[model samples]
Target: MGEWVKSSCNSPVPHNAFVAGRDVDGSRIYVGRAAFQGDVLPAKVIPNNRVAYVSHNGSEHRVQYYDVLVGQEYEWVVCGDGLVPANAISPGTTSTLERLYVGRVRHNNSLTIGKVQPSRGCILIPYCHREHSFNSYEVLVKKQRPKLWKSQSY
Candidate 1:
């Protein structure tokens, strides 16, 4: 249930923030950040109603929201111990990468979705006071969708 807000050059991007994606009209959407290319980048929040399990620093945790980047032409795949580009998974697992989102567990039963920094091996879920880290977190993955087919009128 996230709302789309217009962003301008002067718009303040919170620290560790990343670009989500562009709207239909071509405006970029910024939710937060996630790990990408051995670095952190802006990512979009994918709403989920079901619980999913994740391994954080060798410990298992449950989460409901997925912070990810949507690929334009390529999808991400889970390969062995980590995620790999779709093409790189030819001899690896075909299961598309999912359940890679990160969030902080709040006492109020709410979550603060944030970014992932794989180089540091942690998920940075921001709080009003500061950013918290959960070491042994995984980077978010991007999934590409097939292009829509257009029908011609006879």
Candidate 2:
């Protein structure tokens, strides 16, 4: 039998990790299958319980952790493909973030990525010609790609 934790339970993880799986260990992760296939950024796995799949819904990368008992849900931070794990979350309690993404929209803009400080409520980007720090919604909007150009075109 496996122990269970719920998002609604309103508690931080008692241990750096509160659970385990058959494939990964010592790393943070979700306990089930992903709804959509999102990018699996670099992260430390708990030996065998790492999150191998994700479903990014075009907004923020949202991931859900479910209690095996009542099937309750716990959300985790959807860290981006930056140096930090996309699962990093704010420093309040052990929360699995519901919705949030920090990466460049390569639609027509240049390649970019969102940087994050897990304990701080902020994001950073290197392309804006600014130091990596807290990013705002305005920053995200302005960062969107208005056009795409080839290397030879430059």
Number of the top TM-score candidate: 1
Q: For candidate 1, what is the lDDT?
A: 0.34
Give me candidate 2's TM-score against the actual structure. 0.19
Instruction: Give candidate 1 regions above 4 Å deviation.
Output: 1-108, 136-139, 145-154
Q: Model 2, stretches more than 4 Å misplaced?
A: 1-108, 132-154
Error of 2 at 122 (Å): 1.6
Q: 13-92 in candidate 2: lDDT tens per residue? A: 43433221222222333232222343322111122222222222213332333231112222323333233333323211
lDDT of 1 at 149: 94
Q: Cα lDDT of model 2 overall?
A: 0.29
Estimate, for each residue in 25-129, the C-alpha lDDT of model 1 and write its tens digit: 343443533333333323333223122223333233333332322233322222222222323211111123322332222223333334343344545444333
TM-score of each: 0.31, 0.19
